[model samples]
Target: MRIYLAAPLFNDIERSFNERLTSLLEPMAHVFLPQRDGKLMRDLVDGGMPLEAARQLVFEADINAIRRCNYIVAVLDGRTIDEGVAFEIGYGRALNKVCLGLKTDDRTLLPSGDNPMIIAGCKKIFANTIELVAWLRGGFLSARDAG
Candidate 1:
């Protein structure tokens, strides 16, 4: 299976965690980690590419990767879900791809809970990477069947 790991990648802590997660998931499936696999806006800009062109290239690369993947594993940590991650989840759903969530944080905007739309988008929500890995290892027959 090919998995599109959707997560925040703006800072060191987030990027490092994403790499660690990618390593864990690599044994189970081909993981398309944007930080590692796709074009980086910073690098492109530093290399003399215009900001707009770099942004476009990065966006297209990620969108194409998502199109080719079988699943989207979204990291739903932080007080609020990352905006880009939210967009990816919606896009994945629109394309009929399975969406799974990894929510290590307890914070939420709603007094009730995380947004229903977000919750409904995911086939399953894991509390940690271990749980997510375990679920993936089980073959995801239910997820496939649902789709």
Candidate 2:
């Protein structure tokens, strides 16, 4: 499966986490990330570029990557939902792609009722890295089965 990985990319810790997650997913399937350089937009801010331009670049790149992938695996562990991840989820759902959310944080932080990461129509939500791997490898049998 061509999987688009969406997550927070503003901080070093978050970027490293995403990288590790990408590595974990790569062996099972093709993983797509926004930046080939592995530098998040915030990292570019130190180089004197305007924050707005950096945001635009990241957003465009992420959207383009989402368009090229067959499914979306979103990281939903931050204090607030990453805008880039949210946009990717929206685009994936709009395109009728299979959407899977990975929440590394405690479930208690989430609301009691429904999963916020599931969006309106998404049904799959994995709790952690292990479950995500299992779901990706076993639950998703084929590309046609994803949707």
Candidate 3:
């Protein structure tokens, strides 16, 4: 099984979070992290390409990876969920892939008790990593055994 980790990677905290998340999930399945693994954008910018072009490259790469992945693990912890992460989760759900939303933040943003649309799309939502990883690994392994 392969997992697409969708999260904001703009700052050090977000980057570290994504890295740790990938490490935790790597043992159970192949992990495709848009921030860490999307080399095209970094390479393009490093090679002196325009920021807009680099963004496009990164977006396309992530969308393709999301399509190929069997599951999506999205970190929704923040004052508001990242736009890209939300879109990726929605796209993954539209493709019928399992999407797990990880919301570790203590604060809730929406007064409607989280966006019904976003919650509707996720197969499950987890506030902690341990339980989420265990469920993910168990489900994948059980499916493999069944097949």
Best by lDDT: 1
For model 2, give the 10-residue run with minimal summed lDDT.
Answer: 113-122
lDDT for 105 (candidate 3):
88
- For every candidate, C-alpha RMSD to the true structure in Å: 2.7, 3.4, 1.6
lDDT of 1 at 66: 92
lDDT of each residue in 56-85, candidate 3, tens digit only:
888788888998999999898887888888
Distance from true location, Cα of 28 in model 3, Å: 0.8
TM per candidate comes to 0.92, 0.77, 0.92
Per TM-score, what order, best first? Answer: 1, 3, 2
The lDDT for every candidate, in the order shown, is 0.93, 0.74, 0.87
Model 3 segments beyond 4 Å from truth?
A: 40-43
Model 1 gets an lDDT of 0.93
Query: Of the candidates numbered 2 and 3, which has the greater lDDT value?
Result: 3
TM-score, prediction 1 = 0.92
